[model samples]
Target: MNVSKLKKGVLLAAGLGTRLVPYSKEMPKEMLPIFEGLKGRVFLKPIIQKIYEQLYDAGVREFCFIVGRGKRAIEDHFTPDWAFVEYLERNGKEEYSSLLREFYSKVESSYIAWVNQPVPRGTAHAVYMAKTFVGDDFFFAAAADNVFIGENVPQKLAELHEKRSTPILAVKRVNDPRKYGIIIGREIEDRIYEVEGIVEKPKTPISNLANTSLYVFPPEIFKAIEETKPSVRGEIEITDSIQILLSREIKFLAYESQADWVDTGTWETFFRAIALSLKHSGGHNIVFDVLEALREK
Candidate 1:
């Protein structure tokens, strides 16, 4: 794999999503529904597809999905059923069939591979599982439980990484740094920050720049993960591993994404993500519907 190119990627979707509750019990939070419009009709696409589409659009040709035991739905959804297409055509629902065809084309254009995490480790461990797949490629890794709304997020990140020639993390200024991994750094360029320190959920807001869990890492990251010690939660954290890299004076750049990321860690944000995703899907009334539903409650 070319160091300058990002042709491979990984999606960490193995989390139990305890906060997403009863609904996530049977399904992965990454499988949560979002309103998408294709060929002039609104479609309910899982959050994973939303993530995949963005990466695919950014020129990723291969993907490795880190999933747990109950994520069979994800596999089934990606598998194209030619018989079903014939059935839809026989029933005169050719438009929906075309939608399926369009979806099949995307799957054909890219390679999809899955690795069972089997257990819920930390996010770093989840990413580590894809090391063999990543091999020597500098690849993009994203937390699949998020919906990112932006005009050209991945493209922009790729451009930044190409210019910097090192690991680049997507970061943003947030009011609550306590709930996130804060990047302690000084702005080297306009929106790029040279990472000096990273503390996971600090007591005080030293820096409002929070790690969005979107990274472009080189193959050397596996070595960093191998040297990292587990946290108090008994899980290997990517932040800690990156911190080790920083402590060694290795350069890590943070790119402030001009995107609104909606994580499924909470119900409110999930709904907001569905609404906000409409702007990318051409147009929709899901945002208004979400507002009305919340108003009634």
Candidate 2:
């Protein structure tokens, strides 16, 4: 089974990100700076870009970005800037020019289309907006706020999806499963869990494996979403749709990520994610040196 043959993807980035408050007031939380350079050119790639790059690496060529009304910034970032490229070339910054050109080329090739979700809807609603684009096939879905950091989790999941011929949900075992959508399953192997049931934010969780907001879904999921009812909060929950699919005897599998999963919705988590990213960037030693220099100054 060649998973690379399936070539479509979806990214959910329509949330208001109210938890980040003042910082999110001006910019999308997904666009928050995770790291900065001494030259003032911040390495502030959004969560969307990280997910996009991962999917791109996993052989997903067409991307459907489900965006809200105020997410023009995201669209703009991926848009080609011919004028900027020309300016860089005129100034003899050939390296910078080439880099931007390469980035835009990837965007042009992979960005199939964009779907607008006009209202501040829930995850299910955002996903439903991509139904037209998804058509009738299995596609990859990832939340913009959650980043999967393994060397090849995306590639591994893609391969697993093709081999198993089923929907795959990335799950991780946490001490407090009540804070997430928990999955009850038979442990097939060290990190592989054969899911029997899924409960969203259960009061008394049956299992410690919680949904990590990354999934490869079959087209039938759209139908499940349609049949799903809104929760007490008047929001269409994706978890409800998953439950419906499970009731229909759909085969759902859970795979644990080898790398860390970070949720940057809150300030604490956001800072932690930033620190983790910095450490991964191989600049932690430099950071310590800078701190020492500051102390001496």
Candidate 3:
């Protein structure tokens, strides 16, 4: 039983977010609030926090967030503020702040780190920045834009990687290949696929399996990235790097995300992510609440 032991995670959060515009001009989109609520008092958990929490719960404690300029808010949000906690206690607002205190403690307990990229590069380049942190160990890589639901999908990827001893990718079956990275692979069994190649937004449709940008990779990928050439988009593509692995006869596999893979990169997708989260939590106000929330904003 060779279970993959992926202990570290690399989150690519350095995108310039031109699509997000005016709001993203100052703050990194990762730091934007998914929803503000009272954790006793008002608590604002940013989109990246939800992303990190999901991976943290999946048994990844040591993390490197690949960030760029204007991302200090993300770093500050992760920093433990003991003095603020003490202020609440001194003012006898301890009960009101307990949940936040615990939340901060959970985050502080983990070894979360930040690495800055000089510029906004493609996802692969952002991940390449983590080479010094990841070394040669197998690590999980996920883009911050993906807001996944339910129990540990990283665990699912890890388990499959363990059995197959191959790199694992999380994917979902979608109708449009033009909209996502299409995976061309042969099914070994059921939903499990032995990926032969992957193309980024293909003109001609390949399999409708969309790569969710959630992956468990062998350290060798850093070398592949180094060898990769910049694409027509003028950024190094992870798919190009993965092609190197396939070219070398390395076995790469894809795992179907049992839960939905929600894209939270743009305003529209972010809104949908919030709605889905509320709906999945069985809150009856999902429809009106999400709509009104969007309207009011």
Candidate 4:
């Protein structure tokens, strides 16, 4: 089984962010900004942008963004605004303009498509919508609202897939596994597991390995998702799709990473993501400065 290096990428950003109310009411939650700074300039970028950049850095070029209604903001944001970059340059904000310019360069060089979901569905359905976009190639898929903050899980996952030639799930060890889709597997090697089963938000405690919603899946996953039926919640869960493949004796592997997974879906986690990003930029003091400025305002 020869699995070539993944080139196509799919980003699921179509979910309605009910957990985040007013802030996400108008804007997609994936558009929420997180701290990013370089060379004495502290700034913020949408988490989706960060995710895209990470995937781009990992060698993914052809891209598809699964979007739903009220997600025009995502498309607009991904569009390169050379005029804005030029305006910043004219204003002597070269550092800031350079960042945008770099992002724009990536955007221009890639093949990006926006596929509308119209009605919000679960992750399985969102991924199924990209079947044509992915074609026969193995591709990387991720939830756009998340940013894995440490080591490059995407790069590692791809490398793992090259050797194992199986579907790969980026897993992480957490204290509480009840909230996430937990994996039951046997360790084949250090930080790698041969996945036996997956339990979504299990009541009875399972393993600490939690699915991180980042995957390197073969095109067969689309077929698995197609065979998957809707769950009790009337949503086509990706966990169910994985179970389908498992029952068919298809091997899946989980990569437990050291990356700090930051989920910016709710108010609490959103702010926590900001703090974590600030820390990553070595600008932890900027958080206090922003707070003081807000206090004065």
lDDT of each: 0.85, 0.80, 0.81, 0.89
Off by over 4 Å in 4: 1-4, 288-297
Distance from true location, Cα of 278 in model 4, Å: 0.9
Q: Write the per-residue lDDT of candidate 3 for residues 233-290, one digit (tens) a residue.
A: 8989999999999999988999877786687778998787666665555553656777
Model 3: CA > 4 A from native: 1-4, 35-44, 86-96, 284-286, 289-297
Give the per-residue lDDT of model 4 (tens digit) for 54-160. Answer: 88888888999999988899999999999999999999998889999999999999999999999977899999999999999889999999788856788888788
Candidate 2 whole-model C-alpha lDDT, 0 to 1: 0.80
Which number leads on lDDT? 4
Each prediction's number of clashing residue pairs = 0, 0, 0, 0
Which residue pairs of candidate 1 clash?
none
Worst ten in a row by lDDT for model 1: 1-10
Model 2 — which ten-residue stretch has the worst lDDT?
35-44
Which scores better on lDDT, 1 or 2?
Answer: 1
Full ranking by TM-score = 4, 2, 1, 3
What would the TM-scores of all predictions be? 0.90, 0.90, 0.88, 0.94
Judging by TM-score against the true structure, name the best candidate.
4
TM-score, predicted candidate 3 vs. hidden true structure: 0.88
> Distance from true position, residue 96, model 2, in Å?
4.2
lDDT of 1 by residue, 1-297 (tens): 223378888999899988877888878888888877677677777888878888787788899999998889898888989899989999999988887887888988889999999998898899999999999988999999866775556667777777777888888888889989999888988888889999888988889998988898878888899998999889999999898888877889998877777777889888788777787676666667888999999
